[model samples]
Target: MSTSHDAALLKPGFTDAVFEAQAGFRALLDALAYAGRITTLEVSLDPPAPLDPATAAIALTLFDFDTKVWLDAPAAAGPVPAWIRFHCGSPIVSETHDAQFALVADARHLPGLGDFDIGEDRHPDRSSTLVIQVPALTGGSATRWTGPGINGSIEVAIAALPEGFWAQWDDNHALYPQGVDVLFVCGRQVIGLPRGVKVEV
Candidate 1:
């Protein structure tokens, strides 16, 4: 049996694979450097529905054959997994704990941070990175952000995250170098929230 998402195998990824992936990678780096600052993606893509250009761009730029990806319920039930598998050459894992990256198209249904690998002190870099799709990068309630890349602090109001997510984030941040990092995306805009960042409501 082939599968439902098999059709996604033909869905195109980056228009200019090498150039666009590099550009997208650079954009992500800048987003992380600024931590909560918006960095728009310049890549072109006809990504599967629910996977916006920014989210898809990050996947294409970061995922490789060795990376294992986990999708939220909505994404896994759609063509998202197949698209990632085909273009990124990443294995789609059923469990979040085993994934190097977790694409959360439906953050309202997001799992606890503990569900994914949070890495150990000795291997902090082994933690999972989450790409969460939010409604917008701004125009929601504001929360104060302060951390390594941030000189002072920035107020960010990312819309549509799951209930208790911020509280969960507090515990995650407490893990310091062992917590999962997050990238929030809306349309072509993305904002990185590394684990080292602190958020205050």
Candidate 2:
């Protein structure tokens, strides 16, 4: 038998109901597309330090009984995971490849993007979606973003990203419909990096 979400996360006014959860998910989507932008979100949980607004927003939206989550560092233990389990009912997986969603607390701690599943050619959407919790996302980075959705190119600074993360991503792009998508969270904002996007770092 399984315990209900209501029974697990009983903290008054802390758990996000359905309506608020949708809003959080939307906010995350918008922020990722347009970098350096700060989007305000309604954070219901009182998560500990190092868990920024963007990361918290992501946890609330993506975590559910059907979702499998993986965490690195600071979030590997303590209040962050507990809050996620209590509110979203998402299961935690051991390997990055097995996760439906992977939340990396620190960019520096992130393993190679290829370490996680990039999905097969037929069903590329089955790959893991990475949620990177950045320190501060500001505009004016050297990295240029250009893909299907953007008009020309967009530039933004995603704090602490590894040197090769983008380069490897470019290589992955050649694989076409067989790469992982990504979401970058900072402060209370997020941005989407769909598999189709050609990331030129």
Candidate 3:
């Protein structure tokens, strides 16, 4: 009893489920392991527009039936969420705070970082993870980043993020292990912003 639109929602997923998902997970670890360093997610996926292939790959690798995902307005309008539910079997939640993963198809419409769950002290791993689609990873205003994964400090520029994002990031970073983690994706590239990373705008 599936409509044409519903059928279309089920897009092609990872080319090789096991191997590709592992590669995507490794790429995610590498990105977070080297703060501000751009990592490539090379998995093959044909998700609907506005959902970057890299972001989709990460979704496939990260989400499970037990996970709850929140999609921004623009993302929710598309096939991306349905595709995630189809492949990953994760529940899509209406409330941001209820989500373990939130996907933003348009970075400009992103909600406040604090709107999502930051996790409790006893369960820091319960925090949300944001996968945001940005214009580009470079050619934006440069800011100094320093944290555990960074060698010392690095100059990072991610374009088209909403104004005052870094300021909110400062607040989020203060929460340490309880804060939400982020992966900013554009095309096949992703930049990780772990909760430990500090930004000087």
For TM-score, the strongest prediction is 3
Query: What is the C-alpha lDDT profile of model 1 across 41-139, one tens digit per residue?
Result: 987687897898899899989999999999988888887877887788898998889999999997886899988899988999999999999888888
lDDT of 3: 0.90
lDDT minimum window of 10 residues, candidate 3: 1-10
Highest lDDT: which candidate?
3
lDDT of each: 0.89, 0.72, 0.90
List candidate 1 stretches off by more than 4 Å. 1-9
Pairs of residues clashing in candidate 3 = none
Which scores higher on lDDT, 1 or 2? 1
lDDT of 1: 0.89
Query: Per-prediction TM-score, please?
Result: 0.94, 0.83, 0.95
Candidate 2, which ten residues in sequence have the lowest lDDT sum?
7-16
- What tens-digit string does per-residue lDDT give for candidate 2 at 1-201? 235764455333235467767888677666555543456676755455567765766777667799998888767865566666776788888798898898888888887878888988788888888888776666424667777657787775666787778787887777778877788777666667777777665
- Which residue ranges in model 2 land beyond 4 Å of their true spot? 1-16, 31-45
